[model samples]
Target: MGSEKIRRWESGALAHAATDPFGPGPVPWLRGSELHFDDTGHVVPWYVSPAAPPGPRPATSPATTPRPTAGGPRSADDVHRQIKGFASTGAVTPGEAIDFHITVDPPQRFGVDIYRIGHYGGDGAGRITTSPRLSGIVQPAPLTADRTVSCHHWWLSWRLRVPSYWNIGAYVAVLTTDDGHRSHIPFTVRDDHPADLLLLLPDITWQAYNLYPEDGRTGASLHHAWDENGRLLGEADAATTVSFDRPYAGPGLPLHVGHAYDFIRWAERYGYDLAYADARDLHAGRIDPTRYRGLVFPGHDEYWSTSMRRAVDVAREQGTSLVFLSANTMYWQVELAPSPSGVPNRLLTCRKRRGPGRSALWREADRPEQEVLGIQYAGRVPEARPLVVRNADHWLWEATGAHEGDELEGLVAGEADRYFPRAALPEHQGRILLSHSPYRDAQGAVRYQETSLYRAHSGALVFAAGTFAWSPALDRPGHVDPRVQRATANLLDRICKRD
Candidate 1:
């Protein structure tokens, strides 16, 4: 956009193009938006112009902690930057491509006032200028559902021109509904860089949750992860960034940008290579597993799609390492049913199966494709009690520069009540890095604890903190252990630099 566009400032945003980004157009106004950089005028999406310099990040804090903890480093894919990969529902290559759709729960009333979608990046403490990548007026479309299904839903697709040069990263289609509702779906842009990964996900074996169903153990979905009743109430609006103010219910529908943000902070505190892929983009060949030395599962990566599993396996076989720092890893099976907005019924919950009389909220199709891949939760109990660190000398320990009294970060990221014994550990022979001792749940009931290890394969490196979705909670100030951070960073470095 050159002289054709003008920037406008609203109550909280700097909008470009005097008009709404999504103007009145036909269904799927699928055309690339004309794009030219403000500084160079040479439009390209290859590298974040100015490029990133090596070394530690600048000292700073995000302007707001919206939820908890303090300033932390932000991931490049931290829901910020301009949205990419939503253009074609299929594989895409470099070229001038335009707009992508934001799938929402209920279709939003179209218009442009101040709709917020995806990660809204603002100036943080580093004195870094606000990232100027993503900010546009959203154009609304008619309320409709997937052509295949007759569900009452909505989707908002905005046009974006892929600069002559584009690179790989997690991107999504976010919808800021008219009623102020919002949801994020996955999308991807091809990597211009040749494959840097060495780990062969396919070559290695996939493991189920740490504490799988051990014969007769019990497990819980860990669904009600609330400190109190008050925590469970809230509503999310794609039209706005600030949520957690309204009253609402639980699971699958609730939104928490803060949770994403919190993980980023913990990521910064612990020095994690900021990486993320929208829950929606795992498939559609969005995650080019070959480009990375390793892939990391964000905590609470409970949702899984066929493409996601396949992507991970390929990376592992290629000698790329994988760090599943999440509990409930691929606990549910889901698919992207075309939506005008927020991804709905993507989880394929039991409720959908009953068609009416169904009672269970979760479903079989909801579980990760572990059975076929070689790993699946062994028990029905999804919940895990607070566990005591059991194994202290496992190889993942090389990451912990700690003494006997030292503590490693702990998270409830994993929720295994019991696990199946492997006929074999890693081929090279692996050991349990850690275990939960004296583990008990919120009700003070004893639950089975799980163990973690560095799998026995050239590409298979397993590091599990055995925590729930909010593992960062354990990484706060005095509660956070440097050993955890160091261990995590070391793992990332090893993977990224694998020869």
Candidate 2:
């Protein structure tokens, strides 16, 4: 129900939003009422970019691929450009090669920052979401003018590794420019699951589509990727460099990194051996992803590639379990390219005008492919705080009870029935593990201004944490909240029990 009742409250809430043009929005009393609009008009102004952080950006060069330079001699609104190939998800030729190009620019002023490359399992979680490896020679750091043509355009390549154990996931090359700007390129990752896995294929990477950045020059470092052997692979403890990270030097991808870290941590705590492998590994040897009982995803997961999507579909058909513990999971459109070293993959965020061609990252239709994880996005409501938890006592929440004042200030709670139906689960798979419970109003009216999940679909399981801010609320140390502990334990218990 992406309807207006919520919008009504939203318009009022914005006045106090951090981005508000005026002073703090009306106090809590005026919210959800005409008093919010009292003598003045709306208390908030239109949105504006947040304060820019101090950091370097990846440089681009037009020497390799076809494109204009970054931030140089361009149209007013066209400083960046999107990667050219998107439909290439299922088009890999086993060991075929491909090339990808992208560009980036500093937000403003007369300088440029040094940049790096990211190596992604690509398909493991779909979309492009990790800072895995780097490619090419000459890590050039050109200024704004020179970069538009020589530095901003990212030229990378890849080789598709169609491994025997391929499961739902993609291979990727992440292009990061000077000063921490990023984009994703995806290669399809293949795996063998039950022939019926196609049914669950759509969800393969749903739990962790991509690893989105939390903004600020500092990329999200809360994650690590592992391999099937229980061997530690990608990022590691204290978030040290990966085995190949420094050589690559790309900034970070989106939510995939953080999610991987979160998932691995949870897996270790709950007893699952998580490992990671690239297309090259699959190409050289055979793999068996089903050896593990479940595949995991963690924080801020957002992108998903077609290959990863297909592989996971097969895994589900084979009855493999998936545990998607993140939001905005599996959404980006990624691609892969051929390189002397390996294929380069990237996330598709050409939307940030400060980099590449200043393009947009608006991807529609993640719904059909992303439903496997039990969630899909309608669009981002920037810096929007969602009211979480309605049915506090649903089976998923049996271990805990709700408490007052556990949430951020000014958060709006919605009626149980009014969450985003457009993003709901099909009801045929699993069941609604938990919900953002809603209650009657002072006069006993229901308000559906919160977030909730419904479960359906077969083989795949469903577990929803109605509230959107889990890390700050529950996952961190000293951040104890009864509901979070109970819910966290419940999720692990269910996974173990089912396994």
Candidate 2 lDDT, 1-499, residue by residue in tens: 2432332112322212331212211111011112222113434321111121222212222211211234311111111221111122322433443334333343321111111111112111222122323332332332122111112233443333343433333334434433323333333444443321111122122212211111111111213222333222232321211111111112222222322333333333444333443322222233454554444444444434455556655555555556544344454533323322443332121122233442222234434423565544333223334345545666556657653323432232111122345553444543443333234445545433333333334354444333234422332222224465566556555644643
Model 1 error, position 197 (Å):
7.4
Q: Tell how far residue 316 is off in model 2, in angstroms.
A: 2.7
lDDT of 1 by residue, 1-499 (tens): 2465321110001111111111111101011222223222334221111122322233224431111112221111111211111233322344645344433333234321111112223211111111222333322322211111111222324555545544333233332333332222323344345443321111000111110011011111112111122132111100101111111111011222222333444444443344344444445554566566666553445545566667766656666666655344555443444333443322121122333542222234333333222233333223423434454454444646544434333333235422335422334334454654344555756555454545535555645444543334423222345556555565666666632
What lDDT, from 0 to 1, does candidate 2 have? Answer: 0.32
Q: Pick the candidate with the highest TM-score.
A: 1
lDDT of each: 0.33, 0.32
* Model 1 root-mean-square deviation: 15.7
User: What's the CA error at residue 56 for candidate 1, in Å?
Assistant: 28
Identify the candidate with maximal lDDT: 1
